[model samples]
Each structure stands twice: as structure tokens, then as C-alpha cells.
Target: METVEDVTRMRLVGGNLALDFINTRTGPAAGPPDDDLLTGYPALIAWGVHAGALTRAEAARLRRLSRDDPGRADTTFARALSTRDDLDEVFRSLAAGGSPTAPALARLRDHEADALAHARLQPGNPFAWTWREDHTLARPLRPVVHAAVQLLTTAALDRIKGCEGCSFIFNDESKNRSRRWCSMDDCGTTEKIRRYVAARRTRARQ
Candidate 1:
């Protein structure tokens, strides 16, 4: 049985997925950071959290994988981040959802198979295997994460926001919904302080 801790960890990791999707940088330099783009499993799980599917503990565990076993980090990251055609087909099938043809379902199944195989190779606790564990419990977790993504993407795909300073995604659920950055502590504070100093200089010029 999975514990509360497991779920929480996964949530953190899943949240990153949403963040990676936005990639909100500006100018010629506008691109995902190497770390955010390269870290795969954690980001995928983090996407789940941002979608409100996985608990925090579950997300955290996914995060821990990169730290605990750096060896598999690049490989797992690549696998997780790859935007394969099959995934698109899966999404199409999911959207349609009326006993999708075997070929379409097979595409999704193959994608999951590859993902599960990669996940199993990475080192972690037994629950980590739940992602690839081929068990009753594992089966449900997969769709829960997927459904969370689908729900968020469908409802707020246009409004979904990402941080310019870092790759983090969050729903613009604020009453104002004008959120452009991820957190006040990170980029927000830095940008505000810089602007304050710049404004002070302009006032002195006057």
C-alpha cells in the first residue's frame, strides 16, 4: 500500500510537467532551462500535481529520483519529455473515448509500455514501481495523472501560466488571474527590486 508520503512526492514532480509545458521565457533567449527541459520523470509527475491529480508526496518521490540516481536522470528525462506521435494519437483517442480502435489504443499502450519499462529501470522504493508495477493499484494511478492533465489542459489551456524566471506552471486561479510569474520569492522579488532601482534613477534625473 502506498503511504501519504508517496503521494506528496509525486505531486511535486507532477507539478513540473505543467511548468515545462508553458516555457515562458522572452526574447531571443526564450527557451526552457537545461535543467527543466532535461529532468524528465520528476517533471512528468509534477505535471500531474499541477493538474491536481497526484498528492504532494508522490511528486516529491519523483523529484528524489533525479537526486538519488543521477545516472538514469538523462535517459529518463529524455523518455519523459519526448513528444512522440503516439502520445498525440492517445490524446485524440482519449478525447473521442468510445472504445477507440485497437490501433489507436495500441499506440497508447505501447507508449505506456516504453514509459513503464524505463521507469522500472530507475532505482527507488517499491512504490516507485507502481508506475510500472503491473498491479491493480498501479493501473489506476496512470489514468489519474493523465486525466488531471486533460482536465487542466481542456479547461484552462489558454490561461495556463508559466514563470518567466523558472519553469514552473500554475493555474491562474487568482481572482485577478493576471499572474505572469511563478512565485514572488523567486523571479517576482528580483524583478520588482530591479525595477524599483531603475525608477529611483529616473526620478533623480527629473
Candidate 2:
């Protein structure tokens, strides 16, 4: 079972809420992810807090509510996992220079509708969508859905890319759009070492 420690240690290299959510599972290429951090409802809450999707206070309240209702929490956790998979499929397709399947898009549209239905418009210089303050078990999902909707319907769509070293999808915000790895500390460093070792082996053989 995943713990708060695991959630805290997760690297948020996606640079977007939806992408971060998708990255809960890591180390995938042609097969299933090797690590899935969201083990249960509590882990979900921890991730929400870690990912800045929920405030500590909000996470506390949700934790209390989940403790009082385990069945509902289980359901919410399952739904969240399913939504994450759908998002992975959709965005991975986009990053591969293809359109998302209709079914996946429809599932995402449903999640977006749910998020919007619970949101209110905030009046400002530029009016923005804000989530309603509720103690609902699914509240953590609201921000993630909103981010996904924005990415899908806006210019950010073109900025999404799959990391060359991992299965994580990130919003490439570089000026030259040359980002290839998820992070320099992890995949990038590993790839560099791998290349250096290969070069040394070739030099020795020659």
C-alpha cells in the first residue's frame, strides 16, 4: 500500500495538473507501469495535497469524510484511477501526433462536464472558473478535470509531449520546444550515463 511518504516523494515533472495526475503511474514504455503511487483513497488525498490540487485543510476535511465513509471513498478512488487511464490514453495519442479516440474523448468530456457543473465563475479582470467549496469526496478531481479541459481546448494541446525517457507526459514550455526528458534529475541523468557507458565500451573495442 502506498503511503504519504511515497506521495511526497513523487516528482511533479508534468508541469500541468492533468499531466501530474496521469504521472501517478510511472515507468511505462510498451507495457504496464512499474509504479502506481495512488494505492488507496488515503493515498489519493495525499497525492491531491502533494500535487497542489487540494489545500492541506481541504485534504484534512476530505480525509475525515473518507474515514467516515469507506465505501464511497473506494468508489471515488476507482473512478479517479479510471479517469487517469483515460487521460493517459488521450494525451499519449496527442503526444504521438494522433487524435484521441472518440470513446476516450467522450469519457474526458464527461469528467469535464462534472467538473464544470460544480464550478462557479469568479468575477475579475479575466473571469475564471473556480470550484465550489464542498466536502465532497470527489472534490480533488475538479481542478485536474479543469486543467485537462483547458489543455484539450486550447493552444496547450500542441505543447504536450511524451518524455523520451519515461511514460510521463509533460507540457513542454521551453522557448525552442526542445524538451525531451521528463526531468534532468531523473530520466535525463540516467540517459546521459547510459550514453557515456556505451561510448566508453565502443572506444575500448576500437
Candidate 3:
């Protein structure tokens, strides 16, 4: 059974993945003094799922793979995740500052292709519409979903950054550079409290 911390960490990873693919730095802040977005492939996938860019079945398959065989998930995510190193090389090779073709890009392209293929395979499948008004709506909204994923991925890759403490990706535009954790209200506060308590303990001992 995965703990809450594990799930949170995975969520951060997934977000970072989207950030890397889009080459954007417009996600949640990382910590104080450096407001960087977390990056990871799983986080990207999660974003897609939440944004209605990916089918529930596809998301379920990924989650299952992640839980049952973490190695498989890691391999898939590693291939799917993009990085600054990739963009730097890609942009340098492009005529109009476009992205270049590399192993990582190839992997992302492959995943996109695979997703499209899967979407096509279930053109009329009822399971595709998990949140639809009508469960039987076989609308074949794959094109729209793909477009959303593409746009989001592009945005994330362009605006996302990695967190120093955790390998997450988020947008970093805080004035004080004190935006640590995926959510300041969640991990950030908890960490602050822990640190404060530790400091108090140290003072009492002294």
C-alpha cells in the first residue's frame, strides 16, 4: 500500500513531467528563495488526467503499472519526461527556435503516438466518457484531448522548473523566493512547523 507521502511525491513527479514536456516554468513554487516548479513524467500524466486530456482507462493503466510494476512506470516516465538539456540542444538545432529531435523527444513523440492510437482504438467505447453527462456518449473526443495535452505539455516544458528539495516541477515567480513544496498550504507549512519545533527543542536543550 502506498502511503500518502508516496502518493504526494508521485503527484509532484507527474507535474514535473508535464513541465519538462512543455518547456515552461509556470507551475507551483518549490521553496523559499527559489520558486521553481517540480518536474516528473508521472506528474505530467496526472495533469493530463485531471485536465480531461487523458482517458480514465489510460490513466488507470498507468496507475496500475506504477503500482504493480514501479520499474515499468519509471522506465516509461523517464522516456516520456523532457529536460532542460533536451531543450537547449533542440532549440540550437532548429531554424526558427523550434524544438529538436532527440532520444527524449522521440520517446515523447512515441508516447503521444501511442496515446492517439489507443484513443482511436476506443472510438465508441463507453468507458472513455467517465465524466460525461451521458455515459454512452462515444464522442471520440481524442483529437480535442490530444490538442489539450499538446498545449499543456508545451506550456509546461517552457515554463516549469525542478524543485531543489523534491524532484517536482512548478512555476517559480515568488517575490521572496520562499515557495517550497508543491503546495505551500500542505508540505510547506508542515515543514515549517517541524523546523520550528526542532529549533525550540534545541533552544530548550541549550
Q: Candidate 3 residues 155-199, lDDT tens each?
A: 533333344334344554455544546566555677789899999
- Candidates' C-alpha lDDT: 0.45, 0.88, 0.43
Name the best candidate (by TM-score): 2
For lDDT, the strongest prediction is 2
- Tell me the alpha-carbon RMSD of every candidate: 11.0, 1.4, 10.8
Model 3 spans with C-alpha error above 4 angstroms = 2-49, 54-101, 113-159, 163-167, 173-178
Instruction: Name the lDDT of candidate 1.
Output: 0.45
Superposed by TM-score, candidate 2 places the C-alpha of residue 98 at a distance from the truth, in angstroms, of 1.3
Tens-place lDDT per residue, model 2, 17-109, is 999999989885546788888898888888988998888999999999998999999999999999999999999899988999999999999
In model 1, which regions exceed 4 Å deviation? 1-29, 36-77, 83-148, 152-154
* Rank ordering of all candidates by lDDT, starting from the highest: 2, 1, 3
Score every model by TM-score: 0.45, 0.95, 0.37
| Candidate 2 vs candidate 3, TM-score winner | 2
Tens-place lDDT per residue, model 1, 104-130, is 556555555544553444356633433
